[model samples]
Target: MTKQTDSMSKQVETNKNAGSEHPPVKEHYKDSLEGSENNSEGFLAEVKAVKRFWSPVWIVPILCVFIGLWIIYEHYSSLGPQVTLTTSTAEGIEAGKTRIKTRNVDVGIVESVELSDDFSQVILTARLSDGKEDFLRTDSAFWVVRPQIDKSGISGLGTILSGPYIELLPGVSKESNNTFALLDAPPIAAPDAKGLRIFLESDEYGQLAAGDPVLFRGYQVGTVETSAFNHETKKMKYQLFINSPLDNLITENVRFWKDSGVNVDVSAQGIRFEMSSLATLFSGGVSFDVPKGWSAGQKVANNTSFRLFNNRTNILEREFKEFDPYVILVSESIRGLEPGAPVEFRGIRLGTVIEAPMNINDEQIVKNDNLVIPILIHIEPARFTELLGEQFNVVEQYEKGNIKGLRASLKAANLLTGAVFIDLDFYPDDILVQEKQTFANYRVLPTVSGGIAQIQQKVMLTLDKINKLPVENFIQEATGTLETSKETLVALNDTLHSVNQLLSNQSTQELPAVMKTTLHELNTTLEGLQPGSQGYSSSVQTLQRLEQTLRELQPLLQTLNQKSNALIFEAPATVDPVPKAAKP
Candidate 1:
């Protein structure tokens, strides 16, 4: 069998070298085997084909490796690296296929995120961009904060996912390094900042939660974080957070109270106060007050973790310091009243009430409780409100000489209702304008007022007393006076009556005859005395002669009469009755 196999192998090798279609071994076998001759040629052809197929096996392996490398390169160059940017949150970001680009050039891709071993931060595995790895900076800051802006301002978050990023802040120097430092993600919300913590003892907070406002001078500068009762002290505690810069303005002298809504009010000098706003309407805030000419501002020492301050008081202290303010509280006595309530001086509202009570209650000295009321009022300084007025046109009013600075007064709010509001005004009767126009500038004025109701009552009572007086008494007194007058008149009347009676009693016939005889005798005598007849001429001549004779005789008679006058003068009449003034 060995000899035969060797011979056949030698023959097959010789056919392959010759490129013969049929090997010698096959022809030799066909000669010995008669029946298998038809299959021999086919078998030899197959063997030749098998030998040719061996050469390509090494080349096939080489070709397969080349195709594999091409595929890997295509995916790596286009898809970039798989990088994960871990942040505090993933709210606004996409994972997995999320891309990270440097200068808009794709640098990496997000793969997946997982909690780090320490659980302090999230770990992200990202494949770096191919050779484009200079985007990471060492000093760049990263935050997961979202931008919030609404009448306030804007903030920033490092990643688009509302999550923090491992920001690479590059140094100015051109340097290169290979190590990585894991970073911490920013917090979702910051811890309590430095601010005021108000301790309130109230049961008014039912649905009242935090995020409420704390206002100062009409401006909102802070928000509430929580409202709860302190078990230790049995009081309501409110944790308020305010901006850091403004916290320094608070002081210990400030007083805080819940404010009620503002309403139209009156003050001295016909002044009207106007109030409006939602904060004032629903939930009142705390306010501050200070003494006139006193400074409520001071340097604040941040001794503790937070500093508490009152906003309204700070505002009032700053804005109203140029003017005056009257301090007054709202109570049951101040119902239907409000801030800006009139501080009327005379019939004018010179100022207004600055505040009011939302609702308040009171109990008996030792008994009843469960009381509720509507509103109360608070007055600014009388002088301040009166001077400010509604429009606050101080410069114009000053020019008119109607008022000047602060003065305390009890002014009637309304004449009809007779409600009263106390305030100060500028009508300082005689205080020098540039000198003592302000009450704070001088000694406090004494308060005085006969209340309108009291005065009106007194006047009405006087009228009623006059109306109620007895008419009979008045008539009796008048009659007494009439009687005295009648007595005086009676004497004169009696004289007239007596004379009238005497005249009336006289007989008219006798009076007429007597008067007629007297008139006739007087006429006869008068006629006889008239000069001018013949006998009268002769008598005239005779009278002239007698006149001459009498003229001569007069001297002698005068001498004799002188002696007689001497004799008469020597003896005065003794029997003559003394003349007396005649009596009626």
Candidate 2:
């Protein structure tokens, strides 16, 4: 260690001499430090002066702030208006999932659903699209669309798969709104839909519902929107819509009828069947038509009212006018006459029977001098107003008692049915007019006796002839006459016997020859009167005269047995009649 120390000391001395020759290490380091300091100080001064506010720190912070603000603005701008809707219930709805649609296009979403304060209805809060704020209005209608099957028809079929949705039919209002009442059911037709609205009045309110078609000339032109019964009016009111130009067909005089089904009519011509369409068969409909030879009248205004007929035939002859009443007095039985029996004028319908035959309950019956049946008939002159000009007045003629030869008669309408009707005819044969007396507010018109009356009069005449016969006196006279004739016949026979005896007595031999000559002359006369000769015709006439004389005598014999014609002729008896007080 000592030797090393001595060597080091010698080296140290040498090194010291070397350090003195070179500059000291501290001095060199100090010079280098000064030069570096000078350069750093200048560079530091230049950089400090050139510095600006656009540094990366400032730029990064500013960018971060701008991005945050943009994000916040986008979040706020994307939000939409909130709307509240009241519904009967919130069935088939989810707050976030339920969508509001217009024509199947999403317009809004349900933000929340809760019960109302009264708990009577469900309140729903929805967020509508940004620009759709104007769509929410006082008149806009909203309803929850779900799977529905009803009498009207099936609807919301898409809701079965995609879930329930709120449907909105926008209104025509220009004002904006945020709250709305939900509809329990969809409208038959949108209130703002393009159409013309009209009303119909009917006595019968048929089973008609919303969406029922309205037909014109068998083509569907519109729909029935609603129907209600009016208690005060005792009529059914139907609200309807006719789309577009089809409404132009409606007029004041147009007639509407319920299209129930096929109509069949059996008339003199043939059977007629009318049908609108098959759709009308299932769903009830209304049909309209205008009568021929009539103007269409004024255009149908909004909610114009019309009467609804049950069928087409009823509307054909619906108009009727008042009539004048007349009473017909009949002497014959009016068994088959009844109220509503037609009163005809020469095979033309003129009136109807209002009251059938009944016993007269007034002094007129006593004056009539016959058991009379009074029939009341109503005559409507308007039915024949065209045929009978305005100057022809029935009342004036009746008052004048001339009625223009109009007279009433009873005639058989149906022989088998025993039905009869009043027949008014112009009785030219009996035109002597007489004053008509009023009875029961009706003019008393004379009725002519029918065919049956003539038979009755003839029977009465025959009965009178039979009653005039003096049958008892004729029989008594005939018996006396026959007795007298019997006595005369016996006396004549005795005379004939006496003559025979005298001729047989003596002096007849020569007389017999003379008698033969006379007989020969008689035979010659007989031969001349044979057939094919004028003498034969004269002989026949003589025989006829003798037979007529015999017939005259025979009446006396007939008077002895029969009494029918005893009083018809005067009978002369050969002997005096028996005394009234003669013995038995």
Candidate 3:
């Protein structure tokens, strides 16, 4: 066999060198037989098995395996992180269709939507794009974005046509998370926004809500991020964010008050109308500022707690710290006096009414016959500091005033509203009590009956006095006098009737003609005395003659007097005296 193989190999090499396809089978067999005969010692044929490193059949399977590996790498490389999202409701979410976005940029898609184990919530498995896994921080927020109209105004309007999607707000926390709870509403402020966060507590919830604007001097500077009510504390707590530089304005002494947009103040001064803005008018907001007479204190840090007042006036009322408390025992009814009533000194507010008609048990009421209603009031020394100096001691001043007959009385503040306030003034007429008085542990400030109560009391006293009088007897006497006057009047009427009858007689009627004839004769007689009439002219001539006669008689009378004197004794005629010069 070896000799045959060598002969065949030699024949194949000769064919290959000749560049021929093959040798004839008969010639190849003859050559092989001749080579075998030439080998005298016929070698044992050694049959060696041959093996191949590879085969053509393996090409298809290897190509298929490579293709599968490439496909698997591509599938895994393209996939991002998977996160589980939980929400109360699956309102707008859909499996494989819903997308997650941040700042309106698509970032992920919901792979599946399923119910929680208790079926109380919707769970969504969302797949984010490559490298977006970093956004899944512990504090990250997620919510559905849809058309919403709220107190803040219209938002998510674009989602109306684009369809609802999950909104993701990346948090600042370094810790990563794969599961998160969905928010019902979008956050008021961006997580990364520069601002200050604060907490406010209020006794009442008021009308404030999340997304409400926070105003500084009527200008928006922040927003209400969250609002929650505590069942245990019974207070409404609010989380607020003041933007950037505006946050610097917040101080320890600053006040926060609810802005119901429109402020209508019906005070003793007058009705004042104030509005923050048109936007706030429809949607209520909050306002902050340092209250009047208060100093802006140090800047507040994050999460600082503060009190939220109902209104600006309430904040001002609470700003004073240095004050003294006293009680006023009022005998009159305190119908219009309420807590927070102004305690004024001659129309200037010096204090606030802490309580009207202090709480008293039935036993106390029964024990005291003349039970005067006790009014608790706080007199702030700060109010008088400007006038009485900062060193003024409220208690000292109160004691001094008490000794000098300073008293409190209820006065009508607004007649239309029937509101009353405590008035402080000196009333010397009130019975003086030298001893200090106290009621319910509070120093008593003497009170006097004044205002409407005094008037009512006086009226009641007058009515009582009148009631005590003999009114029936007075009425009877008045009736008797009236009857007598009626009789007198009847007699006067009879006299008048008789006079009328006398005037109505015929002679009485003809008296006018007789009087007229007399008047005519008198006129003729009077005309004779006139200068232009005969009587007047005669009188004038007679007077002239009388004057001439008197003039002629004057000389005769003088002569007669002189002759009579001469006859009585040697009548001497007086000679005319001549002027003479003074003797030298």
Could you give the candidate ranking by TM-score, starting with the highest? 3, 2, 1
For model 2, residues 1-584, the per-residue Cα lDDT tens digits are 34433544464466567765323433443454455575533311111124366666788889999999999999789877888998787888899999999998999999998987888998899998888877778778898888888766798898789998999888778887888888767776676777789988887766566778898878989988778999999988998989988889998878888887677754322356887678788766888889765679988678788888777765653344678878887778887777767777666666778788644565465445776777888877765665676445454465575555667888777765667778877676766654456776667776687655666689999999988999889999999999999999999999999999888877775788889999999999888888977899988999999999999989668786666556776555558678688688
Q: Which rank order by lDDT, best down to worst?
A: 3, 2, 1
lDDT string for model 3 (394-415, tens) is: 3466576534667778888887
lDDT of 1: 0.48
**lDDT (Cα atoms) of all candidates against the true structure:** 0.48, 0.75, 0.82
Q: Which stretches in model 2 have alpha-carbon errors above 4 Å?
A: 1-97, 109-131, 137-139, 148-155, 174-193, 264-273, 319-584
The parts of candidate 3 lying over 4 Å away from their true place are 1-78, 150-158, 267-272, 319-322, 361-368, 390-395, 398-402, 462-584
Residues 100-119 of candidate 1: C-alpha lDDT, one tens digit per residue: 44333445555666677777
Global CA lDDT computed for model 3 = 0.82
Candidate 3 displacement at residue 149 in angstroms: 3.5
Name the candidate, 2 or 3, with the larger TM-score value: 3
The C-alpha RMSD of each candidate to the native structure, in angstroms, is 21.7, 25.9, 12.9
What is residue 78's positional error in candidate 2, in angstroms?
8.6
